[model samples]
Target: MATQHPNALTRALAELPGPLPAFGVIHIAIPHTSRFTVVGNHLAQHAELSLVAIGIGVHIQSLPVGSLVGIKALTARFAEGEMRIAAALRELEAHGYLRRAHVRLANGRMATRTVFCNQPGALERAGRVVVAPKVPPAVPEEAPAVPEEPPAPPPAPEPDPVPESHPPVRVPPRTAPKPPRRPLPQPRELTPELRRTASAILADLRSHAKELVLSEDDIEELIPGVAAWLEREVRPDAIRHALTADLPKPPKYPAKIVRHRLTVLLPPPLPGAEELAPAAHRPLVIPLQNCDGCDRAFRSREPGRCRGCRDLAAAA
Candidate 1:
């Protein structure tokens, strides 16, 4: 069986509507140099925009204004939170790359218009294009003129009295005695040395942890504890060991940790007389002067030595 061709079998074909005119394509021109300009401009630093901010700016330039789906689209595309998108938009506006104006429409409608610019000067140009409503001139009313009064005549001159001369007395001028200058207080004997030690320790810790950032004030405050520990005959290595022990990985608040350890590990004060007194009659003893070695107040029969110094000397 020979099948007849469908085109040969058809008697007539209805004409199809002429192909609809192809919709016009929208082409947006973005300069490649914009990337260099955006990063090199002072606005980038002033606005403190991260890579997220740059992404948001590029999208804003490409997308249509007042797009309700922009937030969701940006979130999906950039893998960022809505708040971050909003913040980036704010940064762009702050740096003059974006502007929003509330405009009243011809039909008494209000709309928010978003304007994006590649350069800051475009914002000024956009602003100038908006013509302000002309204000009518006000005709000021004339004030009544005030009459001027004539000047009064000068008074008559009085007669001068005869001059009386007296011998000028020679008096010595009193002079104030200059105040004595008080000597400036000298720096503490241990402060400079302890400060140097503190600086070295802080530098070492920063190198090791990279997170331990201490200011000069923090170092100054911490040095006193270090000095106290040194005065108590504790070795610097011991202090370092104590600080570094049991530290968390990438320790948080290193200054706080150091301070806590320094305070908690401080040696207890030397035993008082109450501890040395006999069980039968415990008498109260008052410390007379500070120890020469550690500057700790203690009751001692000797002139210069505290009990700790005496013990150290005996051990030596």
Candidate 2:
């Protein structure tokens, strides 16, 4: 029979020889949707690695830190791409999945630092009650009551004062003020896939030059991926073009009027050759023929009058 050893975290901590550090909660992500912030305090210096071991231990035990997990498991799972993985972290943070670990440093100052996925299980969900505001009950009106006065009494005496001497007093000067705070560091923005998407959109538009009519279904399907890509990777100009191009222009008039009067007028292109007038005499004569009206056979295209005469008549 095989002997089961304690978890890596427990084993590591057991191996530690001296006093632990005065560190506070070390936030970690719980692998699943259980709402909690896992705290692994490393009392000693190298405990962070132990914490990592603990996290794996807890993860293997199926007790994930829930609060740090906002996305579906499939979306939150680790990928090889740094940008994608970072993007997943950002998404989680934006949606309140994970927060910066506010740990108490040994020097007694509180500092917020980053960790990959801090999830604390039971502690994260403790007593978070949403109390609705209460509406006070109405009071009934009543009649006013009469006021009452009071009486007076006797007075008393005084005491003597002593000769006072002054003692040397000391005053202290104010301490120098601390410096101004700098802005928080901004996390990275987008991933390579997003950039690729944006580039693809621009390429597609340039390649397909036509206004590129898309059906509602197509737009709906493509919009999310495009928007995500633009948000993450594309340059401002390219993103602008990708988003605004081919989108419906704002109404010329008020929206109400535009919506009410809007009509989809997809009229056909101007009629084709078959719709134009047929030749006057079926087999059109090249040389002039007789004009039945004046019994003339002119050797010209129009025949009615010679071509020059016909032109002059029309002009006249």
Candidate 3:
């Protein structure tokens, strides 16, 4: 018998099937004309950097200068939580992709300054960049009696050029303070029974979904909506499923999500007994009876002979 064909080599030589999903990712890349960030394979293919870290670095680079990459800002924007984001930042810092320093401002408040280094290896060898030159102190003027050599003009020490990879660091200007988040409003006028049942269900939601752990205040705000579902005879388990199912990865606004689900997925109230249509009356089924003269079976409302048997008897 002939030897089996080489499957791997054949598949490799053949054109990739259009309809089929082949192994590995295929790129039909369009060259970017603008708004593009250049990333080196050193960073892109770092052996030690985690996927999260690589993503964060790229995101930071693509952002406009002075765009906030703080923990809170990142958590709100990306699916990764604060802890993971923080860890990724630290990873980038350790790998020389980023540097963070705490500096106290003129207003006596501390601020974190983050610097993105495109090529960390070059920056390390070149050392820190100097923004301004250090001027030598002027020589003290002596009296005419001891007029020795005239003092020379101070030599201006030229500052070192910024490393090829490290750009000039610029701090963002101070702006007006932001307003605090508005408080959530709790529902009122719900009956004790309904409120209790709905609250219980909401409170227990954390068990099924770790990300859905809502604050007590948020639960209070969302009670009315869940109670509405309960009024419509929706089961507690079903209510749980609707609120938690297919939720976005690492849901940031748990309260808003719960409130939205409760409002949108609420079932219509069941109709009352009187509102339901009465059962339709079915026609009575006749029983099979034997004919008196012919002993033939026939269907009749009451026990009687078949029509043929009755006609024969009449004739006789």
Candidate 4:
């Protein structure tokens, strides 16, 4: 019978010469002596990229030139769905890690060309340090010698107190202008009641999903958008569904997702709604007519027997 080491992990750990790291990653980096790729800390420690994007980016960087990095190819290679891969590729493209453009081939067929950047902004940094070539100084032309004029007496020194009156104006440092904020989508004006209703709907979203909890400020901010949906004859339940349905698992920045959905999925005003409004409220006018059976004036939609005569005839 073969004997096996029951506590293999414990035995292996005990064999280490030094005590284990306090906690966190212990780099057991082996210098690549053969085929390898170098990843910069910029990509490895990106603040905004998802783990999926970072892994996909590293995998792409490791692949040799001429390797297929298309969305379809990547979907086949990774366990992630097509949407996640596409989103990762988009993230890479947006952050200057990748670029894709269609190009016409020699045979007139269109082909997509992709570019990968290991280090973004390197070109801009290099461009900023360009050295201008030195130019030769021009020779001075000979001029007739003239009698030297006496140097003008130095102007009397200006009084310090007078200068202080016109103190050097310290100009504030200029900064880049912030992009204009997009206005909330309000298809129609909201009544006070509508605003209250909208507020209630937003406040109750947390009941369905804990991740959808919104602060008072968020609820206030989103009220107009929800009210706008309500103004379009959209139901409160529908508004809740639009904001909460298909939410990301364990939503991070749930407010941002809600805001995006509010803007993108906003329904248009019901078509011909304005035109049909007056007709619904219009008074129903029935011209006075003499009943043919009773020969008496009665209010009816058309020339028909009065209700009393119809009832009596039915009884008979």
lDDT-better candidate, 1 vs 2: 1
Instruction: Estimate TM-scores for all models.
Output: 0.25, 0.16, 0.34, 0.35
| RMSD for each of the candidates | 33.9, 34.9, 25.4, 30.6
Residue-level lDDT of model 3, residues 104-186, one tens digit each, is 65533588777777678766786752211121232222323323332222333444323223344544323435444333223
- Model 4 Cα lDDT, one tens digit per residue, 1-316: 8897658566655654565656544323223334545567678878899898999998887665567888899999999999999999999988978865454544334776676766667734643211111111222223233244221223234322111112222212224354455567774677999999999998999998789989999989888888888888899888889888888888888777777788778887777855677886877787898977888899887898988889889999
Enumerate residue pairs that collide in model 3: none
The list of candidate 3 runs beyond 4 A from truth reads 1-23, 102-111, 129-316
**Whole-model lDDT, model 3:** 0.70
Q: Model 1 — which ten-residue stretch has the worst lDDT? A: 129-138
Off by over 4 Å in 2: 1-79, 113-316
**Model 4 CA deviation exceeding 4 Å by range:** 1-113, 116-181, 273-316
- lDDT of predicted model 1: 0.56
* Per-residue lDDT of candidate 2, residues 1-316 (tens digit): 9997798777655554444435543222113223322233321122233433343323322232222432344235533245544564554444332345554544335876433322333224642211111111222122222233111111122222211212212111124344443222221454565545534553454234344444444433444444443454345455434433443444232222211211111122355565675866355547858764455666655535555556767889
**Tens digits of per-residue lDDT for model 1 on 1-316?**
9997657223222122233224532222222312221122333334477767777775554443344435677788777899998788877888777666565544334777665555566436644321111111222223233233222222234332222222222211224343343222222456667668756775566655566677777776677667767666567777777777767777677777777677767775457687877987965566487788888877865658788987998999
Local distance difference test scores for all models: 0.56, 0.37, 0.70, 0.70
Give the clashing residue pairs of candidate 1, or none: none
* Ranked by TM-score, top first: 4, 3, 1, 2
**Candidate 1 wrongly placed segments (more than 4 Å):** 1-47, 64-70, 129-316
Give me candidate 3's TM-score against the actual structure. 0.34
